[model samples]
Target chain A: MTTPGRTTAEHTAADTLEGGPRRGRVRPGGRRGVPLPLLVPALAGLAFLLLPLIALLVRAPWRDLPEQLTGGEVWQALRLSLLCATAATALSLVVGVPLAWLLARTEFPGRGLVRALVTLPLVLPPVVGGVALLLALGRNGVVGQWLDSWFGITLPFTTAGVVLAETFVAMPFLVISVEGTLRAADPRYEEAAQTLGASRFTAFRRVTLPLIAPGVAAGSVLAWARALGEFGATITFAGNFPGRTQTMPLAVYLALQNDPAAAIALSLVLLAVSIAVLAGLRDRWMTAS
Target chain B: MTRSARRTRRTLQVAGAGAAALLALSACSSSGSDSGSADSGSSASSASSSPELSGTVTVFAAASLKESFTTLGKEFEKDHPGTEVTFNFGGSDTLAASITSGAPADVFAAASAKTMKIVTDAGDASGTPATFVRNQLEIATLPGNPDKIASLKDLTKSGLKVVLCDKTVPCGAAAQTALEASGLKLTPVSYEQDVKSALTKVELKEADAAVVYRTDVQAAGDKVEGVDFPESAEAVNDYPIALLKDAPNADAAQAFITLVKSAEGQKVLAEAGFMKP
Candidate 1:
């Protein structure tokens, strides 16, 4: 009887393994009965999230959309937004990944405090962050005064300021996500590589980095999205100038004051671009996990 | 068994606290409505005589009128013991948009007739808006005018680092008009979203000068020195105030408007650098 029970268990385990590849095709909540309390609220939550997007589509001025989009100003703002967001993401990755590794793989006094401080931008209002950036980097600011006198580098009302503001707001998301992933990843592999006559840096680059590539990709995507949608800091720190510091969000806001239709058109464009990029990236990296 | 009993007691405590909160919320709302109705009824009965003003009067005014309007709001509250005067100050266009979109405001005071027209066009105003004050453009420079910016044409000087309000706002539009009238083209380093922000850029010394309203320059005090140019006379902005058609506190709103137009209100506005309309 014990032999027969063990055989049945092995057969069921094999069946689950066979079914693993097809799991993504299966519809959730279809096989088992979902409790009504959860089902109702779950559906309601979906509707609540989708209603605003649906309204935008419903109220869209389809006839004038072509003319609205063909405007040079719209394209300029869109190009600037994409360029700034991508640049900000690159900047975040260059510094944020190392910071994440430091937090996860190393030990130090006040590590807990440092970790909390790294996430400060996540809670601070973006406008306040802008003000703080101004005080730190504006032409007459504390550090900025020295920079102006010595190097003649003024950041406000410049394209570079837009990237700096976006990075300031977006880097925290990348750091937090990467740190969580680093914590969850097995450190034994890194140790094993170090044991095989490899330097610590070599172990990190050859062994640890490849293991955390997916997490880094996910964090990059999160940071990119946050940077793309940044408005308050960009407007406050960089100020708005067409073909210069004015990104799509700033254009949409200024347009809203005068022309609601044009604002809606700009919003739809931003929405479409963000959705396409997110969907494309999700299919590439998210599906692998 | 004790653990289960404790869990039940905690759940009961949460529910009891929730019920108390709901009761308190309902009581507060009920008293608010009771006072509103009582005030309205008393005013209606005394309509032939001096109607007593009570309840809250919510005024949506332009950003430029903030200093003077705030002073008048306090004086209104002081005169009427049972009344409260609240002001929502922002860009005239933004305020008009809010009022047109059915913001529960008693009065709408805009920085320009153009913005007031938006409310009037929507039939949101009960009557024709009256021009209360006028504002003219001034060049706000760093204290002592170190840049020596004397005229509108001087702003066109290269490396001057001038800031202007965006053309969408009243101050920006006025600035644009002044620039056009003078036939001088000036490219500012930044086009700020509002009058206050334009003034702030100069005050912070980020920009050498900014074209903002006289009232804003005055409000900045010693931080910025105001430079009056002849072209400002070509683009003076007329501030318009009106009572909304759907005013909840109609009596109180009327009284507030009266206070703003009164001699005392004019004195306060003049002190704030606003010209009589």
Candidate 2:
């Protein structure tokens, strides 16, 4: 599930670009240059994607928005969502970089199968993932029983469980992104460092680390977004409890059942946070890379 | 991309499409059954003189009505010969919301009067909804009642983990009413999203007990033990059914509703542990 200290190609892009001066001239194809066939569907797809969000805004109870967003339960769910998503992103970084490296840089038996399994969570329903987690890590779970008997720890229905569930669903994005960057990167730089008498660990730390930092950063952002929106697994594994395992998505769902206005308010907050994070990261990342 | 990378990417794309197609295919097949009965109306009027109801009837029902309603759907199909019944079972609140949002459902069956009111208030129901069944709460414990949870108050004991549905749903609201009527301020380990999830917690033995509908516990078989409590009498959730305003098959939909309220339908509901309305 985890590997550590792996570097990828996007890090080198970050490093080389950071040191070099900006030299590109502005080039614009312009919107009118787009052909009709592509333009039509592209605009339609944009509308398709944005229409529901636009409806959410249009139908949102703007009058009650202030009260709904300021509610204690709303804040509690928001805070917990941010906290767990960040933690899950951090955990994914710590483990996923290495797994990505193994997949990208190494030749092993069943490597294809291993890569498929690593990204299986991306395709599996989060509810099924939660059920699998319960069978593996719940109190009565196979390994969870041992954890309970020895460590007296129960993961389900706890804040930690929310983090674990998010990580399970979100880590694949990190791994896939980093591995793509790693495969694209030239391994000759690491070889060059090794020839200069640097150990494999030292080579990775010095040369590969700086080279793949951008991929790591981008992967982390992708994972954070995925984690932030996580619903099914978190609700299934951690259960919904305000100020505990009830994250923003769960709160939005339960709220939709009763107070739809509150649900819309919560959804808007989540949307705003996602937009803010992406906007903040794009400046630093697009410039660095 | 390298040859292997491109190949792997192709595999991922195919697998993703396969997964998506599987879901789409399942949805299509269920609705596809409707068209199969379109040409089967030859000599169909001779059997019961029930006004040769044909075509498909889409019924949006509460999750609690799954078993009994499914049985009724099959029986209705058998009686009508050329008629098909497709069911969309989910939380009554969600089903009501969908119907109000213009989902083309023939009939709507809700687990509670409150949820039924949502549809009725939206002017989606063609006529007055008739109450069909009532569901009472039961404390679902581990098999053999290992927690010894005898009453609503007993669930509050320390070291006991209990799960209940969230207050937004009917079961949860009933549980809240039952708890309050018993004068108990019990805090459960978690408030699950639905009755089935609450029952699942007890079934998995993660929680010592759960307050769920009696029918749910009965449906779960021997996985969990049901403990009847007197306070449950105060919070009986009434099930209601009505034909939709924009029903595609109004005749078939109304006939299906009649069958559900019939003696045979009542018997099926009773066998599933539902009480008389």
Candidate 3:
């Protein structure tokens, strides 16, 4: 108890090898032969994680699945869900990638603040984002009021509003994910490409983009998923009207209010579509990696 | 392959046994024959049958009834000692949807009979619904009527940015009925989600005028001036109240319903620019 560090050489040696020796028998950090301390906590974590999904699956009405799936409105919402999500993904790509590059590569004042500000949408509640959007772009919104009087262009209660709302919520995911990857990637490849008689734009378009294509693709998947599930912002900003602003999540939520079976059917459709796309992309990613 | 093989074999046997034990453990975790859950279920049923209620009663009512309902809710709490009353005030359709999906609400007061029917049609409502109040559409405009909007006909003038409730909502549905009856082909800049949102546009002076409930205009106080339209007679919305069938505290639900349809409730409704039902 009075020793400054350790008592014996054997004890010191044992202490040094304790982690390695214990891990050697079980494969370090692997699930095999997890210590009781780790095993108990890991199991508890898994149950906590899977409980909600399990509840949904257990409560899902399986008998009316076919009838509910056949409704045209279900298909309409699904179609709109896919179309808007994809459009939102494309829009995020167009705007977010360049913004990511600027945040990652360029030097400017408020760079730290700008980076924080760009991710503001990520933390801002989606409903609040809708209100902020209204204040800025709504008919009587700060910018929107002028646009309304000058151009008579109304964005609310339309398909365009749905797209805008989704984009507002989703673009941050694309920006943040891609920006992380850009910071991790080597910038020398881009510089070298530029030195090889290529313009900065060409270097970025041809070389840097191809190099980070996987990260961009991954980011797009995340963004698309976020867009697919977007609800509050879309409904608040766009207003829910059938065949116009009402997308799949909104329909599913509304259906859950009246007919839970229909909600399950819609959820299954969204899940199937998302899984299929993700699995296809994941296969390509695994092989390429 | 001598001592190492024997030790590995023993380890393997231990691991496989451990995994099998883990699988069994998980299976046991989710087994359905637990007396605890069953006991809780029976107790819940008993609680429903004869409640020992000592909790706050939450009501989700239409926003149009905000002023009067808040007053009534306070009065209700004062009458029922040791009982607190909370309200989640919003659109009728929204409140109905919240109720249907097991929102912990004791009473639902809706602006329209149609929205209440959505809940009753689903068999989510407990008993027969009674009309508690009625509301009629009125033209909301900027203070002093800068646009010179007088009648429903004037709202249809070209260059007037008339905001209306979307047809999906009851307020919007009423507006449509009024417009149809009047045969006025009025095109609005936006069809808002609810009455309050529609009136907000007019209140903010963004829209030239909006067709919102008289109660909404009344609720807005001096922010906007309301013009009583002749066509309002064609589109009077009936307000309905009912206790949900699956209400956790049926006693509280019934009591709240009684309070809503009472003579005291009529006074509150009338004070909020609503007609006595």
Candidate 4:
């Protein structure tokens, strides 16, 4: 389902890779014009993408906005969303970066297959991923049954479950982004450090880490944003409990059932936060390449 | 510029021709089905002696009605021959919200009068909704009842994970009413979006028990066990069915509703553990 979107993005990235410097040169001249065929549809596409967000702003209950935001439940959900998203990003960074490095830098059998499997969650529906997680980690699940009997640990319906579910769905963005960057970065720098008596791990720590910092930053932002907006998997795996697993999206969804105004108000907060983060970082890190 | 404009006009003409062909194909298929049903003999015709109700009837019903309503839908289709009955089942509040938001549905069956009122207040329902059946709350425990949960208070026992529908949904509101009537404050492990998911938590053994409709516990069939409690009497939900104001197939929608209110439909609902309205 998501393959077409990813392919289109890849094609766009390819176009940018070739068009960037040439477009820059053309900008200096300031003589050429955008073709009618492209400009008309481009404007239409921009409107189509932005109309919903604009509608959200237009229809928002502005009078009740202050009261809505001041509510304790709204703050609790927002705080949990931010906290869970950051923790999920950190978890993704810890394991995902090393996994990306291995995929990009090492030689292993069935590496292509392994990379494909790693990205399965990106295309698999989040709800299905949640069910899979439940089957694998629920108290009566295969591994979970053992965990319950031996260690007395259960993952569902807890704060930790929210982080795990978010990590399951969000880690793929980080892996794909960092892996693409690692493939683009010159391995010769790490090779040089290795030749200078630094161990492989130290070489990665000192040399490659700084080199791919922008990519890591971009990836972390993407993962954090994805985690923050996660709805299906988080609700399915972690369940909706205030101050425990109920994040902003779950809160917004349940609120929409009876209170449309409150739902819209909560949605506006999430939208504002996401737009702020994305816009603030885009110029410095996201577009660095 | 002229060449591009010509190409664009040509593209539009092609699209227009394609849409015309699609419309023609649909018209042909509908008529084809009509003729085919006419040829199926006197039984189908006699059963539907009243004005022929054809086309598809898209019913937006509450999740608790899934089992019985599905059986009723099949019976309706059989009786009407050329008609198809399609159902969209979910939380009643969700269904009402979608209907009010202009989702193209023909019939609306909500689990409670409160949810039905959401549609009627929005003027999305064509007329007053009729109560078809009622469902009582039941405690759904895992098969074999390992926890020995006999009453509502047993669910409040520590270390026991219980799931309930979100209070915004009908089942959850009813469960809340029942809990309040019993003077118990029970916090579930999770508040599921709907009754089915709450029951699923127990069926999967993730939670020790769930408060769901008796019909759902019956529908689960040995996956979970149903335990009746007296507080359920205070929270019995009345199911209501109505035709939508914008029903594309209002005739068929009306017939479907009539069938639901008919004795045959009542039989199916009773078989599924629903009570008389």
Fnat: each model in turn = 0.48, 0.57, 0.16, 0.66
Residue pair clashes in candidate 3: none
Write down the TM-score of every candidate: 0.88, 0.86, 0.72, 0.86
Which parts of model 3 are misplaced by more than 4 Å?
A1-81, A146-154, A191-203, A240-246, A250-272, A284-287, B1-55, B78-81, B93-103, B114-127, B141-168, B179-192, B201-210, B243-265
Q: Cα lDDT of all candidates, in order?
A: 0.88, 0.87, 0.80, 0.89
Best TM-score goes to which candidate?
1
Q: Could you tell me the C-alpha RMSD of candidate 2 in Å?
A: 11.0
* The candidate that achieves the highest lDDT relative to the unseen native structure: 4
Name the better of 2 and 3 by TM-score: 2
DockQ of each: 0.32, 0.32, 0.14, 0.45
Question: lDDT score, residue B15, model 3?
Answer: 70
Candidate 4 lDDT by residue in tens digits, B131-245: 9999999999999999999999999999899999999888999999999999999999999988888888888899999999999999999999999999999999999999999
Interface RMSD of each: 6.9, 10.0, 6.7, 5.9
Candidate 1 ranges beyond 4 A from true positions = A1-31, B1-50
TM-score of chain A of each: 0.88, 0.87, 0.84, 0.86
Candidate 1 lDDT over A13-124, as tens digits, reads: 4545454323344322322334334555578789999999999999888999999999999999999999999999999999999999999999999999999999999999
Residue A274 shift from truth in candidate 1, angstroms: 0.8
**lDDT, candidate 4, at B241:** 91
Q: Where does candidate 2 chain B have its weakest 10-residue lDDT segment?
A: B38-47
State the lDDT of candidate 3 residue by residue for A77-116, as single tens digits: 8888889899999999999999999999899998999999
Worst 10 residues of 2 chain A by lDDT: A25-34
Tell me the deviation in Å of residue B259 in model 3.
4.7
As for TM-score, the candidate ahead, 1 or 2, is 1
For candidate 2, the per-residue lDDT at A254 reads: 95
